[model samples]
Target: MVQSLARAGCEVTLVLKAPVRTGRLVDPLRGLPGVTVHSPHAAGRIPDHAVMVPRWAAGVLAELDEADPFDLVVVRGRQIAAKLAAGPLAGRLWTYLTDVPQHPAEFTGAAFGELRRIADASRMLLCQTEELRCFMESAVPATAGKSVLFPPVVALPEGLEPRAEGAPAGRALKLVYTGKFAPRWNTYEMTRLPARLTVDAEVHMIGDKVHVDPGDPGYAPRMQAALESAPGVVWHGGHPRAEAMRLTAACDVGLSWRHPSLDSSLELSTKLLECGLLNVPVVLNRTPMHERLFGADYPLFVATEDDVADALDRVAKDPELYALAAARCRAAAEDYTLDASSARLAGYLADAFPAADEKVLAAGGGRKLRVGIAGHDLKFFTRLLDYLNSRPDMEVRVDHWSALRVHDPAKGEELLDWADVILCEWCGPNALWYAERKRPGQRLLVRLHRFELYADWPRKLAIDNVDKVICVSPHYRDLTLAKTGWPSDKVVVIPNWVDDKQLDRPKLEGAEHHLGFIGLAPSRKRFDLALDVLEELRRDDPRFTLFVKSKLPWDYWWIWQKPEERAHFEEAFRRVRRSPLLSGGVVFDDYGRDVAAWLRRIGFVLSTSDDESFHLAPAEGMAAGAVPALLNWPGADTIYDTRWIHRSTTEMAQSIADTVRLGRWDADRRDGRAQVRAAYGLDEVCAQLVDALAGHAPADLGPAMMR
Candidate 1:
């Protein structure tokens, strides 16, 4: 990676945790142009190696940065990145994660917390695979746009020719394995492959044994015995990386078959990439990632130890299959070559750090536009606020309201006085206050969600003083005009944005049978309808389950205080407990900010609301690669495709069942994801919001409204 950066014209500074006494350690990078290595001395006692190493490294980096400011600082490990993130140079860090949690269940505790801190501090997150990038974005919502793909770069032997021959004609078929002999790697099991093959074969192993599983203490001894005594096996342990690659190049096939438990990991195997670069056919598991690299029809894919032995026999017998596998490996490996990786790095750097342009400043009259956002809850506008604050052409401040209709009068008046444009987040009292007090020439914009349109706040808002009223949907925009008698030109539609990059993640195993519904409050959200669908689906397929992520009725005082709402929820709970099928089928998870992670278990997101201006849950579900089954609420067709919209619970359940039974669930999910990304992507919608906040009125509005 350092070589790739240096090759891309970057002045790379390589930092080592400990000084290297032997020249062999740094021999590969020697004489590389524009690359420098630094190993700083630790002066004091090192209490804990994990904590002290990072601390000493951070101090050395701080000193180096002070002496010569770096355009960017790259760190590989999560621990080191977290330590450096606490210092002053956090903004310049480009964190490259070599190790990360593989499953959603693993994303917790202190290590995961450090990952989040590192993500929040780093300028860019370099991921080793597309799946890892998606996991990082979903696990930590902050790393959405900054998280990028930087797959493993294959380093081939110098002047090595790509193999064009089939399996050796007269001799044994040589096989190679080039990583650790951890229990999960199935190295011990691989040692027995030579005995099982129909043709004579040689198995070459080239790495030290790593004991990782404490539960099975006998694994290490068994592995040692197999490596030493197994027939036709030659264990060449712990060679230098270059030498290992050369040894692997001479082999006819690579062994990468592993335990099935690791099949769901979000990391790509570097060993597989090396084999591909050498044009050697590898016997590997049939994982989604491996299938993508080597097509599903690749002849060497194996699921079990017995399958591995069978695949080897078939490869030895068929020369045509051997050649095809070799060609496919070489073709797939071309994208991960050193030159290709360097070009990708250079492109990312160019896009991340563009040359400063004065056009935006000039357009804004030689200064940034001072925009003030006033609201009690900015949950819907959080991404927009972050976007506006990140821009060089705009300055933003916020006057946070204490309640829906309450705020500090002094702070509100001060913001009104200072801001060139005041954006009222909701058409609540803040809008009424800003509309009446905003000075002439200062633009005032009010955004009305569904709740406010039904409230008295919209009627009380001074529409004459407001420059524009932003509605999340065209339906709400028209309703606002009709209800408040607001001018048609003043009301404009700007749909809610979905962070597609953050939400788009791979579905977990058996997600097709799982359905999700978020927010079942206010009685109008129609929790009863969701139960009807779940009940109907379970009647046909008992594997179907409903995962409800919501705040319980008692959690919201407004809903619990009403007798009708209390009765509605109590009856629903009774029905769930009384039905034998529904008792274990329905799960109610606590509502929280980790919606993306929760969505992985959900294949279908249910929007069974009676009425909604613009329900965001279905869009978010689509972004997460989950098909949405939405009720045909009023104006729902305007926001979503009709295929997702159903008229009744029975129809919705039937659609979901048909999708699963016909194996069309994944295809529908892919289509829905693409559609939602095109319509409600964060960057696109935020850009539109910024234009409106900057006093750039819609084309339909007259020029008189524009600043």
Candidate 2:
């Protein structure tokens, strides 16, 4: 409303109850004309821009009336609304209520009722969506007779270029998601889709970090590494609205996802408008907001990730269909414009505060599901939520860290009551205890990538409550099961899925003498063994190539293991660097999945790890048709199948020799690719997860006994 009024030449006064970073606000709006920033700090000065630090309910109540009053005041959410009602401004205010506050019974307070009452008293209301407008009406039935307006588009700078569409013939399908994500957005959901969607579409995300505290010890670097190490997605950190829109304009699609909460159901996302205005076709799952906006626009609703390409296929084959959808998006957007919306709101305010908008009561009547995921490092989780929201069927309600002191089974039960399934990656020992004690109905599915087990944290994580534990590799699963004493029935081995496009990517020229392995953490990855493999190859053939890239510590080879083994491995790594076997101080390209080009040049890829799990390195190499020779073990064997496993160094060497002699792995190199397709392709694996969770209950409900 403010943006619209400002654009209309009004001297807009912006008030912030909380004093946030100047970099966050002032930097972006520094030079805008007719914009006055007001907060508690400048309450008495009446400066154009004022904000109060540590704003209290009492402080705002006392200050709002004393300051320069305007023709209109926009109260952003419930808290602001309450202040308007309880203070001297009550009879003279307009409520810009964006969301209906529906609190749990235990936490419900008089303030919530007061906020509703204040909104009811307002003559007019402004909401983000018609759904929101309806929700507000129901919450305060008396407001039904007053003025109401849908949320307005956040105005973009004039003359801004629209985001471009991908070229029909030459461009790969581009899928972009832009939004501020909390757990409710279901970012983890996206992780399931990348490996499933087979189109040449690139997935892009713009989101704020939700779970990790930058101030917390050891969090910053770990979070940074995870973002750096993610296999097949792009992350552009939070940007200004203008820059974000500019980025959005270059994409082909947009997404808005929410958990099944009354707040979510009543909410309409700003990105929806931005994407539509930018001519980016949106793909949404079934939701109240989606139904309200695009119910008749059948072409815009996609039910699955697989359905996405079909939607794009229509756009690809028929320009007119794309144009038609683009036009409807524009029409819906105009209905949400600030000028049109704020005008209706102005009239509502003129009539005096009436009653709460009646429609809100009806919008809050669903059995909203509240799912929770536990973890401290949220960068990965946020990405996961973004991905989940891409799915049309699932909605995540609560995504919060389990507080250590809050050993509340009721909290877990509350989530279980609302959740269909619990998707957990990180949890301490108590999480399981909490899950186990919850009322018998929820289903828990825990994901254990290699690091989770190798780090020795499971003993501390209460594992008994988890109904199905997902492991990325058979080797990791075996090790974890042996360590945790968890039954085999509780374990479900699901390898990390890779997109199919990665399988068919063009191979780079084979290395003259290069041998490569990718992954960090030298100890578990056995970079020392990588050195040994190189040395052994070099002894027989001087030109033998050796390339090792890992995130493991440099001195892990020199320390932190049995003395005899450490010395042996350290010598091996040192000798390889000094000897003819190594091709320079091995290029450690930190992390990224562009290893296909590197693997193509290498004659062979080798894994000499003492421990095993489904090694992504060899599976990826095999996907590129690069023959892999791994330490035959549980994880490696599971992925390669018995037919492809090599038992020893002699067998490993002979396997490579045979590949070279035969010129390919039989007449079925295509079959090699097919083997990976059947076993580890992204789409095939995600389908497996969807199937696993479909007939199940939420994990917190109880153990397998409940199932």
Candidate 3:
């Protein structure tokens, strides 16, 4: 891992806890470019136990960091990570955990608490497998977006080719096993393979006999005895990693079969990856992770000792089968190569620590900017607020309003007096109040969404007092300019950001048959058109269903009190109850913040609203890998792809039906996900918001402002 970082042009500093007399461990890393190694003096004391070790290491790191601050501190152990997290350097820590609990039962008491601390403190949790990443995130909810895939890196011996294609005609086939002889690894059982095989074979084993079963103290000696006594078995004890790889390269197949109890492990075995890198097929237990790496029909998966023998015998008898297994192993190993791992690591690091803008950095002059956010119902701005609060260069405070047009006057005046910049989330009464009373030299920004354009607030807003008028889309930006006759340059577009990381979850089974509709109130949302589409879909396939997630119209007095709004919903509900296909097909679910979880069951998100500034439902669904079916309302083409937009309800329903029947649902889902991510990903959009708040023009604002 250190070499991979050095190769990627990173300056790495290694701090050793104790001195090393033998250069065997640190010799290879001593002379690498941009690498520094610091070891303690020979007389320095070493901590006796695991708990004390991290504490001692933390003290040493703190002193070194105080002398010359490091950009990042990478730690492997959870104990040290949690310890450092409580210190001043917490924000720069990146944790890589190897000792993760394999079962849910193990995540109780101190174990679960410790993981939560590490999750909360660390900037990144380098996971060895995707399954482990998912499991860790699920177990500790705080670790959701922090966990990243850092799979085992394959570093093969230089200039080594794969094993020869065919087995020798007259001689016995050679098989090898490398790594620990732990009880759960089933190394002892592997030695018995030669005797059980129908074809003659040689079983060679590498590494020391180390068993960790408190119940069985003599398991190690007994295993050693069996390795010596078993016929056709050769035990090569404790070789260097490079030598082990060369030895493994000489064999036709490698042994990675383990105890069935360990099948629940989410981690990938490094020994198995090494064998694959050598192009040697491995006979391993059929775990879900292994099955995903190599296909289900990989031809060498084993469940028991007999299965291992059978797999070896089958491979020895057929040359074509041996070649096929070798090719599959090699192909699967490509993703774990050093170059691939390095590229992923570099990209993740770049994202985790983006280069600060020189202008913004210089403007603050090492002092945090005092930012005051004044708004009512900050649902759309919550993510942006959290991001700004998390930054080291900004000090943020919120002035919550009692209503859209109501707030404590004295409290607003106090915030206005203290803040360097004021951001009005909505161009509502708060914006107008701030614009009318803000003092000189205080920068003010107001963001306008759809409803505000139709309201009197935008026109009554003191435009001369405002520095910038932010809109969510170009269509609205133009509308805001024409409506209020504000300067085009002052009105800039920064689309509503969807939290792609939160919403990009795996879809559930049969999700393709489920369609989702959100926010059906006020009639303009066009709940009727959604029903028509659902009816059209059910006509072709009875399995198609519509799931509605929204607050009932009666919940809002404004919509229910209006006769037209009440009648529109009453007629729609009557039709749904009367139609045979739509009776059980439409399901109404209560609206909540758990939209990310709810989206898992939806395949297609419907946006049949008469019009919108920028409908967020379809973009969010796209992030969750769902295809979107949208009506081509005015200005809809500017925000979404024309391919997803349709002229009428019939066209929308037919497009969705054709996509499902022709097996293009998954393809369309992937395309929509990619497009939405590129256009309105949270990171990119939030960065633009930050830039606007920091007194700098957004990089992408030129095109929108010109239009």
Could you estimate the TM-score for every candidate?
A: 0.82, 0.43, 0.80
What does each candidate score in C-alpha RMSD? Answer: 5.2, 22.4, 5.2
The parts of candidate 2 lying over 4 Å away from their true place are 6-11, 18-35, 42-71, 102-112, 164-167, 180-184, 191-194, 210-232, 257-264, 309-318, 345-707
> Tens digits of per-residue lDDT for model 3 on 599-643?
888999999998888899999999999998889887787888889
At residue 625, candidate 1 shows an lDDT of 92
Question: lDDT of all predictions, in order shown?
Answer: 0.83, 0.56, 0.83
lDDT of 1 by residue, 1-707 (tens): 88899988899888767555677757567669988876553333332233447777788789889989998898888778899888988878899987777777878778678887888888889998877876676676677657877888987766776555676789998999998888888898889888999999989999885676689988888888888889989999889887898888888999988889989888887888888888898888898788778787999889888898888898899998888888888888888989999998997676555432354354356788788999999988876786776676777899999898778999988898888888999988889888889898888888889888898998888888988888877667777778989788889877888889768766777899999999989788998899999999998799999999999999999889999999999998999999876879999987877687789889999999988988999999999999999998987877888889998999999999999999999899999988887788876686577667666657453111101
Q: Name the candidate that leads on TM-score.
A: 1
Error of 1 at 485 (Å): 1.9
Model 2, 1-707: lDDT tens digits are 55555655557766655554555655444356787665554455333354433236435545544665655555566666665566656544566665456333322557456655775555456655554544444445445433255565655556777655433356665666676434445454543345545455555677556455445545545444434454445678787777788877877766654454523455667788877777777766666456556555647566555565567667656667766666666666776665765565454432332222222222223432234565444543442453343343455654454453344556555776667666765544434554565455666677766656656567766556667877665556677778889877777766665444334433433453556677645456666666655555555665555665554454454444666555655665577567655656355543443454345555556777776655667666666665556776655555675655667766665565556556764343455566776777655565555545553322222111100
Task: Report residue 595 deviation for candidate 2 (angstroms).
Answer: 64
